[model samples]
Target: MVATVVQMTESKTQIQHTHRVFENQKKAFRNNPMPSSSERKENLKRLKRALLANQDRLLEAIDRDFSCRSKDESLIAEVMPSIQGINYTLKNLDSWMKPSKRHVSVLFQPASNKVHYQPKGVVGVIVPWNYPLYLAVGPLVASLAAGNRTMVKMSEFTPHTSSLFKEIIEGMFPEDLVSVITGEADVAADFSRRPFDHLLFTGSTSVGKLVMRAAAENLTPVTLELGGKSPAVVSPDVPLSDAAQRIAFGKAINAGQTCVAPDYVLCPEDRVQAFVDEFRAQASTMYPSLRDNDDYTAIINERQYDRLQSYLEDARAKGAEVIEINPANENMKDGTRKIPLTLVLNATEDMKVMQDEIFGPILPIVTYTDLDDAIHYINERPRPLALYFFGYDRAQQEHIIDQTHSGGMCINDALMHVAQDDLPFGGVGDSGMGHYHGKEGFMTFSHQRAIFSKQKFNSGKFVYAPHGTAAHKMIYKLFIR
Candidate 1:
């Protein structure tokens, strides 16, 4: 007899491992179900405890990953938001989970209507490197609160943080109930193919399309939180310095890696120079050292650094004047590859930086003669994830909100609209596909099963036999018509 060898490929091994994990979770969920409201509250409490207990370690991991993440920023943006999400879900989950009483027409008064929110088994979350913990845990909190098992695929760019998260979570929850997978893009692709009940992804638009396509094989619902060229419009009424400070703070945070960061600035033609000056001044005060500032984070890796460099080079080559607000000094430039907090003046529509999302410290200033021109410019491109308008006039803010469509918007500020738990966070069209954050997040991961119950009595038996009779006509007119 000849001996035959069967080699197992990495993909096959991963698929099998994921299948086993899913089956185990499914079994646990079915047997020891999280159906009771009290159980869900307890689970959320445990998650909060885990986060608070490991706060320092989590911050350290993120700092190590980004090399310039500030403790204060991390706490406010990532840590606190996640904890608040958990708290919001805990307070409202009982009411959210209760079967909703639906309205019924008078003709159907004898019958009852209700919608029950049930757990969708095995929700998959694919997190991005930017705001890794918040993106991962935010969706996880919603899924768990809705009584579903969750699996997270951490980004490969932040390997250290991903590993630490896996270690921490494994110790807190069962592997089958809540697990984390850390690998490269191929692994993420494989994770997307799993037969999940629902999938949530946070990343670029190009990758969001791939995730959607992969999920289509299983007919799974997907929620994509993608980025775009979000614009910030500064009207004439707002104080230039105040507007500039807020915009600069939002854009400079995380070194412009935030998904909803303002990608470009729009202002009246007369105020363009003033806005640019204030922006440069604010950025200087905000980030004292372009190369060594702890508050200013570096690009994730060499590829992103190169991409930013290419974007600047392309804009410069195309006649756009570049302004470096705070360049790296000689002493601070020894081993650090830091791109200065820069601005691009006279940015035209054709420039590469204007055409794409400038996910870096480079800010583009575009001057417009009228508000209509600004609105037209925004409408011409794909809808953005967030829009910022800096004006004190409520009517003007309302006008902008009514005319434009975005994932979210902020008045007199930039990118802070997402912090409201009462509001849903998401993108429209090319920016992204679904919304999530408090009740919306819970509903996104849940399957609402509509149920109607009837007692053991069959009425209107005479109408079933004859469809062309007078009684049928009357019944049709009264009920159907």
Candidate 2:
């Protein structure tokens, strides 16, 4: 009973702290509501420079958290995309901020309409454990591009990298302008409950519900980037080797812990064995020795590792074929948390691996009779964050594009569309909702307020509240029709 009271008191105190931070940012935004474009650009420049200056330390911190995260992977997935996103935002902020002119109806002469993009004050970003830096920086770039103050809540699972991020944020900007908050689950809860102008969360679907429920209290607008079982469909015409190699690359990176990684593969019945062989060859060539290879990354923690193990065990018990791809036949009983590519053949709808997002180095291949069968298979499940199709047939591709539903898609390749700065990235249905990248991102954190103005005109007087008049009748007949 005593401990419960103390815990309540501490939570209340932390809530107060979060509220204070929001108030400070609110006061600062009111002081400078419309900052010049140059100021926003300067903010981006500082963030990019700081990132480049401290790239090595940040990478090391993330590696420590993941036990054996590849430095090259960090440079490619997290650092490069973040820097590129900043540059893209800097290049396009001018055009994005310009007021868009709209045509006025003939009924109202000497009137003009326009839309102005204004900042939404404070934005709260909740970062997940995977790709911590990129997820945080992506939203931060958008929020700052829209000229809003921001407060970020880094994941507790990644303490080292989160602490490093907090240090960088503190050193680069004023606390009122941009602040980083880091703690356990309770701190995250408090952070979400605060009434920010807008909120963006990138994580699993279960946690996303809690975040959204908390935001409902304050009516805070949200942009959720949740994950689901994204599927990859291989056309019959495409060579088995070609499709397998591309899917292998997407599933191998970050040990297949990526949010947009190819969750499963749909191959023709005759080609499943060939696809398996090609995938094994490709993955083996990429990771020669799983136990000692620096190129391959490990699971983030013991809980995740055990979770993947249980998934494999559950599939095996259900009579699904399990093939482990260890080129060097390395033993995993040691302290190394690394896992080889495990393919589950003959996967069925009832298997646990088929139901959940296996965010690990596990790939399941299911056989389909025709293209329509593959499309139906994808449609039966919840929409995913990403979908990949390997085929060059233009008509078939168009049919797939027109029929399938996913947040984002890539054809003839995998996981490359998210890197394109010109495209907006997001999800639909259970996967997620809303988009944020490039101009779409700028618009996400901004409010496009519609303005209507008239210049020394009395046209509106013709339709005034005075009823049963000739002018009102003529105006109604002319305009209402």
Candidate 3:
């Protein structure tokens, strides 16, 4: 019995080792300081090579974790984006690394001003389960490019992929440069509480708050990629088939687990039925059945599946017409707990589906009388992470862009806004706090230190010593005026 007890305790101890791993990484970063530009570029190159070499393994791991994540989807969404991000960083790293010169006023003519980009020591990246590899490596690539050491805490939901990634990292890089931590939420909480120089969290809003509060204890700066009820506005001018096909594809990808997925659709009252019909036809062609369709992905786990079910039930209870385009039995033996590509008509603002970020395959269609009404509806809510507008009318597109505030916007497309490395990705207000990806990611991880150099000749000494003199008064008046 004592031996069994000892074994159990040891197992628990091993399970809680993520914190220790983080501490070790922190110490390593402190010892080495910031890496040079060459080092940063080399590390990124190694990462790219590793990813290219083990592409098949990485896809398999993600598929295993997500149950039915397609190879094409994983490659397109995760691998390609990561590679593109790396290439973008590599091309601009030299310019990004250079010190930026600042203009000096005549009053301080003797001083030269500039800003230096410095690494913020070690950065902690807390990744979410969906798109685990992309989230983990994407931030890691940016942190490395910014000359900062990184400590990554992979989501426990993707254990197999996380473990494989950890193994890959151990083989390629030194632990002092990059370390991987994996465990349950307790370990994640503990990891978040650590005193890292910077922390970037990609997860839900509730969890983002916890991470923020924890980082506050250390006064650590954070970048939060949280979720919100991102909307897709279909103007009367765009073709119904095009709008429907784009929205349906975006909502169905990864079973709508994407943070930037179109949560709801806002269409003109007269075109609601036409939009619904087109959406149904497109969804049917894309996914014939929720159960055995290889293109469709299952919910991450049973809890999320049930949460989606609850939303559907709530909408139905409130007299909303719920339409399932490709309905399948919830109980199936093939490990596909597929929720239908559903549309809820007559969904009111007070309904549960509209109240929060619907992070599943359900799309709520709300009808609006005019463009102003649609804009008003979006503006009333907390700004979303992404706002998608489908229309060929340039004036209407610009109107939506000008009236609302979202982290990003895409015209005539859904979720494709995030595909551009040139654009910054994040949220505003309740959605999230900071932006990352491409150049923004580098800036997030770096500290732009304002530096000023004074020349030998004391040009501004007159203003420094005598405050009440007439000459000082004249100088001050001239400068101030």
Candidate lDDT values, in order: 0.86, 0.93, 0.87
Give the winner by TM-score: 2 or 3. Answer: 2
Poorest 10 consecutive residues by lDDT, candidate 3: 326-335
What lDDT tens digits, residue by residue, belong to model 2 across residues 1-481?
Answer: 9987886777677667678888999999999998889999999999999999999999999999999999999999999999999999999999999999999988887799999999999999999998999999999999999999999999988989999999999999998999988776898988988889999999999999999999999999999999999999999899877888899999999999999999999989998888889999998888889997878999999999999999999999999999999999989769798889999998988898999999999999999999999999999989999999999899989999999999999997889998999999999999899999999999999999999998776788877876889998888898787
- Deviation in Å, model 2, residue 178 alpha carbon: 0.6
- Screening candidate 2 with a backbone cut-off below 3 angstroms (N, C-alpha, C), the clashing residue pairs are none
TM-score of every prediction relative to native: 0.94, 0.97, 0.95
lDDT of 1 by residue, 1-481 (tens): 1221122255456567777887788787787654688877887898899999999999999988877677788898999999999988988998899899898665544667899899888899999998989998999999998899899999989988899999989988989789888766777888999889899999999999999999999999999999999999998779999999999999888888898998998899899888888988888888767666777777777788889889888889999999887744535345455677778988887888998888888889888888879989899989999999998888888889999988899988887888898899999999998889999998998888998765655454547874788977877888884
- Candidate 1: clashing pairs of residues: none
Candidate 2 residue 306 C-alpha distance from true site, Å: 0.8
Question: After aligning candidate 3 to the native by TM-score, how far in Å is the CA of 425 from where it should be?
Answer: 0.8
Residue 272 CA displacement from its true place in model 1, Å: 0.8
Looking at candidate 1, what is the lDDT of residue 250? 91
> Runs in model 3 with CA error above 4 Å?
1-16, 327-335
Name the runs in model 2 displaced over 4 angstroms.
Answer: 1-16
Q: Once superposed on the true structure, which residue ranges of model 1 sit more than 4 Å away at CA?
A: 1-16, 32-34, 327-333, 457-462, 477-481
RMSD of 2: 1.8
The digit string of per-residue lDDT tens for model 3 on 1-481 reads 9987776665466446655666776777777666778988999999999999988999999988878788888998999998999999999898988989999888888789998888888899999998998899989988998888888999889988999999999889987788888767766888888888899999999999999999999999988899899999999889999999999989989989999999999999999999988998898888767676777787888888888889989999999999887644444434467787889999987788999899999999988999999999999988899999999999998899889999888888888888798888888887888888888888899999998789688876787764789979888789786
